[model samples]
Target: MSETPHEYPGQLIEQVRTAAAARTPLRITGGNTKAFCDEPTRGEALSTTGWAGIVSHEPSELVVTVRAGTPLAELETVLAGQGQCLPFEPPHFASGGTVGGMVAAGLAGPARASVGTVRDYVLGARFINGRGELLTFGGQVMKNVAGYDVSRALAGSRGQLGVITEVSLKVLPFAPAEATLVFELGQHDALEQLHRWGGQPLPINASCWVKDDTQASAPNLLFLRLRGAVAAVEAAGERMLREAGGTRMDNAQAGPDWALCRDQRLPFFNAPSADLCLWRLSVPQTAPVLNLPWAQLIEWHGAQRWLWAPASAAREIRAAASAVNGHATLFRAGADGAPDLARFDAPSPAIATITQRLRAEFDPSQIFGQPA
Candidate 1:
């Protein structure tokens, strides 16, 4: 199929219907930047770009409805202009990752630990189910019905079950002002501090720690962010600073710092000459957490760890994570590895059964991954 939808209809319903009729698989691509996602897609690829835009925006209601193909960056720009934000701070997977991809990938940024995840903010969705039929659920208004929230299910499905064409998201007004409280402490103490804050209602956006492994002398710099009014932020920082016995650092790169943490592009991302494999580690927020000697970047308040486990020793990484009830995925592997990468961790039997059923329902003909 040519890039120009010359013969094919750019409509979401028509596209899926055509794929179903042809028995061709469909691969979904919004912004194609995050190619290092879950399993490499098979069959034909579908682009949601042509079908993108914000259909509804009620600033007062704090809700916005948009087509699935919209770029998150574009949405963020619009929301920022309105003094609002996505709250979850979905990562920019790549230059091409779209709103659809954001939900499907089910990845959230630093603030995720505090506010909520992507699925939490999704109000509803419209999609072309596996049977090539367009289905809609949820309402334009926030906090509506609970009848089979397909919108939440659609998230992280990777277009395996349906083609999401429209979405309703709950948004929040941007905080009146923003500030990050930065302090460098020992890794042990930093981790302890994170645990302590987890128990309190103290306002914080993201808590992250970075270590310089080789020297073993690197300060485990911890960062805390607050957004709202200037006075509140200042007061919170001052209180927290005194409580932790740490002072505030410069705020020059506060925003960028958060962004880098979300995209996994910090110094930790460039592990050992930028040659080590990058793994998105998901460990439970409990005792005896992962203790690595090398440099590690903590985001989502230790819920998510961007690790650099080189030599493609996935077995060691997986084994360690499994021992502690943790899960790991090789986000970016070394060049020596295979191109057909596996981004999913082991799934439970029940989940497997459910996933298979969902696949059958949204993609009876299995046309979703079929790139057009």
Candidate 2:
């Protein structure tokens, strides 16, 4: 909240040092908005909320360096003021979401498929390793070929490797034009159309297909967003409407709808029953309709799928995802709280070896809590 930056690198280092000497695991926390994201780890809390503020912003360079604990909303507001934004459109999840949590979670919104992932925009980062030593990687530039790009790896480490202290991110200017189109298409038809448009030079940015139980006449629909230069957007919008047979939604209505989809506030995201958990499937966009028996909301042009089903169905769900060369994550547990299932799929043998090596190098004593 303070205009000036609030940093405590010394205090953070000292705490880590003391914990390392005792071989104590530390759970790095920021805002705690995404605590439910991964398996909860037990350890002494290392709160990063106190280490907050924007370190620098170079609108000309399209980069911003900020302390890890700076509020996500505040960062977005600053970028909006400059007519720029984090192209990935990271999700806040809740009010207290912080920059550190955003990078750590590495979950992107609908536009992710078009722009990139959180790791793509992460230019650089600084963190405190298990040895209690502060280390920095990458820089505030688009290209840095000096050393290994370990900075981008911190994007989705989930605090397992170290406690992220600060980060430099690449931002992009807002699109000069934007438009949303709605089509009354079923899941299969919608995906077919998206794949077709994807092959062309269309300015398609984001797409969401869901069954609107509230609308009896047209329950199945696909909401597509296009953003780019004025001419491109206009041309794409007209072509899609004429050839695709859909109506253009007013910006005023579409804007909030997209936001809701980004933050999982849409009705489709709501759990119909307390026993059902939220599952996220990351598959190839061309993957066909899954035969799973559950309500689904497809996004990212069919790459990301959200479903609600009991945790007991984990085996079937995970198998279904794997068949399409994808992975399934138990994004959120049921109302009863954390389930016995793993939050993420187990890494393959090769990836597991690399992950273990990285953890050993950065966190030799395993002082950082491991998310399952």
Candidate 1 lDDT, tens digit per residue, 1-372? 012242322366676778788887778777776667556768666777777777778888988888777778888878888888899888884565688888887878888878889888888888877666778888766558753367788877777778788788899987777778877776667777878877876677778887766565666788878776788778888888888877665667677777887776666666574556778778876535565544567777777777676745677777777888888888876765545445667698999999878777767887765422
| C-alpha positional error of residue 23 in candidate 1 after TM-score superposition, expressed in Å | 2.3
TM-score of 1: 0.90
Best by TM-score: 2
* Deviation from native of the Cα of residue 111 in model 2, angstroms: 0.3
TM-score, each model? 0.90, 0.97
Model 2, position 32: C-alpha lDDT score: 91
Number of backbone-clashing residue pairs for each candidate, in the order shown: 21, 0
Poorly placed runs, candidate 1 (over 4 Å):
1-10, 146-148, 213-217, 229-232, 273-275, 291-293, 339-341, 369-372
Off by over 4 Å in 2: 1-7, 214-218
Report model 2's TM-score to 2 decimal places.
Answer: 0.97
Clashing pairs in 2: none
For residue 199, model 2's alpha carbon misses the true position, in angstroms, by 0.6
